[model samples]
Target: MAHVATWKKDMVSEIVKDITENPVVAVVDLHGIPAPQIQSMRADLREHAILKMTKNNLMLLALDEAAKQRPGIDKLKGSVHGQCAIMATDMNPFKLCKKLEATMTPAAIKAGQLAPKDIMVPKGPTPFGPGPMIGELQKIGLQAAIEAGKIAIKKDTTLVKAGEPVPPGVAAMLPKLNILPIIVGMDLRTVFEDGTVYKKEVLAIPDDYYKTMFATAAHDARALAIDISWTTKETIVPLVTKAFREAMGLSISAAIPTKENIKILLAKADNQMLAVASKSGYKSDAIAARLSSAAAAAASVKPAAEPHKKEEKKVEVKEEEQVSEEDAAAGLSALFG
Candidate 1:
């Protein structure tokens, strides 16, 4: 049997202790992050999480040991490939993912690295003066021309597509052009929380996305409750208002007169009577005089109330004026009908 190194034993012990103490254990890929940036991220996360970089074999062994007590913790070993680190935190796995994602910084594309997105050089003036640099630009698939004593890209050019390796010449020119096409950070692969393993796809959702989804679900639930007449604080008011409105509509349609609707019903009846009399060409001087007197009384009382009353009357008049010509024609047809 090979001799067990003291340092490796200590590392495995520390990892086991962390996993046992923390509720969340995550595996993250540290492939593209630079050393200094990783240190910076570690410092930033010190208060909330502890990140440990160790050999994959050591990490797998720690996870296996943790699984003995925490059950299902060993599932994280499936994601333990490439350059990886173990993150232990009491924070929820989703929030930990977001916190780590926030540490990402855009980095310039490097030779032999796959482009993270489509790289485009804009058509505009360059910092380079007119010289062999123009040929250098042209050599890397950019259309270069002399404009206003500076090298200008004649048209926007796509140097590389996503998932394709950046050409060495293009990668070299990208820095000169001040274009960064890659983002480097601690890319979390999976997490074990409370006997459940969450993958990147589950944890990558934005906070607002979950909020919106929950709000929509709550709204749908409230609507369903109101539909089924479920009595809860949230649904009661809207349900009552709906029920009242529907009852009012039925009462008006059935011509059932209550104190609340009696005035409106009388007004409708008056309007119908006027319509019938007008169609028959029958004019009653007594009825006209009474209506004119009533209008005068209403106008006199309205002005005496307050300036606000006059403004409200003006708004009412405007609303009446806004009735469509088609509505007026329909009313006329109803009168004859």
Candidate 2:
């Protein structure tokens, strides 16, 4: 017995030292794990984390010794009862926790094991057993009648709440309701890293949480890629395609005018603008040229600088001609006389 105690103490010391030195440690409670299942779990955890099973008392003692740096180390002592395993790793805690949950299978439930939450099984008809268990089934809202000397649940009735004690009646009806009171999946008890501690409840994340996280991360990544002009299957394909089409239109006299392509561009714009105009039956080029000529003529018809100069000059010349005619007539008359 003394030797056995010594070995246990040494094992506890090892665990404590390992935890303190390692930057990342995940504490897993192995309570209620069956022997075969534990073996399989060990194999599964081999690649991701180191799994250790130790006594509660030893773990508590080691944690007590290191209370200064790890203040809440004692809290982990409570979860070491029944059968518990400590999983330690340096990987991302949330991701590792998620992967661990994916490796669960159904198992039988034992009495006194705490229910993680309300245990619910649907209401169903119980098979006829004509046995003592039938009485228990009827108490929990299950219908059981004797038929062909066999006991089964005709239909499942939902279990009311988690942690609610399973009455003997309901326990007997388990065969029929197909309700197993065991938590078969992996439960993350706590995670510790970088002198900090995180409990299982906090890390007991849901599928949607990771889904939303990954989705948001993906969106941000795509936005960054676009900002840096890093084209990929995600960003460049669609945006580049749009840019290509726009550039082509600009090159083909179909977009805004520039000095190099102004004439052709304007011509196209003019044709398009006239398409909705009154149908004079004129070709697009003809209509544009006529419009251009009209604009030029309107510009050339600006008001003259001296508005009455030409009119004054014409009046002066007309007066001079009249005067000359008068003078000539006088001379002719005088000569005849």
Candidate 3:
């Protein structure tokens, strides 16, 4: 076998160490980004991750070596392409993806390069003074005119649609118009964690994606638990409260008197008696007021109105003044006469 340099072997060892030690390892594409920007990104990511650049062969070798300790880590070898760098981070794949996305910034489109999106020249004043620049803009299909001693585009124009190559003339005109039509950054390739490889599309998740998922899952879990009555720390209080409410409702509907619902039952019975007396031509002030209110409500028909929850008034009657339940039921007949 040909002799391999000691430095190359040491570099491979270092990469393998990073892959094995860090819980999260990622591959990112650095193609087309400037060196200074990459350095700045490294500083920005210093606290979160360790970005390292090495030969593709060295990285592939490192992946194979790391696969010994981290099974399936070699699956990341495919992401080791041109201008690739690996990062060792403690952040989960989702968070890392978000951080990586923040690195993108507007960059000037070069000649013969593919347009990232439709290049729009709006109808407004431009930064160029009138002269040959007007002709340059017109040559690239812009409706440019000289107004107020400066060149102004006459109408909104799309010089290049998305996925179309930036023609040489259009490319020359864009920089002069101060338009940066392309986005450049470190494009994340894959994330490796616990022998699993997460691709770019999979890792590209909205910031609220997990939060919304967790919230929905928690709500569903609580509802399912209540349905099946599964008891746990988070579900215990709600379950108990629900059970108490159901029991109270059942007692009231079935006229089964209990200490909790006794006062409500008495109030309900009194309302029923008053309703019966009023229907039998009772002319008392209270009956008149109740009837008028009922008529007003029936006329309006407010279906959306919530059930009115009246304040409960406790009346402590003396033992000598107390009336039995049967006497109260027949009490409305006396008011009717």
Best by TM-score: 1
- Per-residue lDDT tens digits for candidate 3, residues 178-297, read 899977788999999887899989978787888999999999988999889999998899899999999998887888998887656665665665566555766777656655655565
Off by over 4 Å in 3: 1-24, 42-58, 65-71, 88-98, 206-212, 230-244, 255-331, 335-337
Local error of candidate 2 at 270, Å?
Answer: 5.3
Q: Tens digits of per-residue lDDT for model 2 on 3-93?
A: 5567877877677776666566766766566778878877877776777776666666766765556666655655665555666676777
lDDT of each: 0.82, 0.60, 0.82
- Which portions of model 1 miss their true places by more than 4 Å? 209-211, 233-236, 283-337
Indicate whether candidate 2 or candidate 3 has the larger lDDT.
3
State candidate 3's TM-score: 0.70
lDDT of 1 by residue, 118-237 (tens): 999999999999899999999998999999999999998999988899999999999898888888899989999999999999889977997899999999999899999999999989
Model 3 clash pairs? none
TM-score per prediction, in order, is 0.77, 0.48, 0.70
lDDT for model 1, please: 0.82
Could you tell me the lDDT of residue 69 within candidate 3? Answer: 94
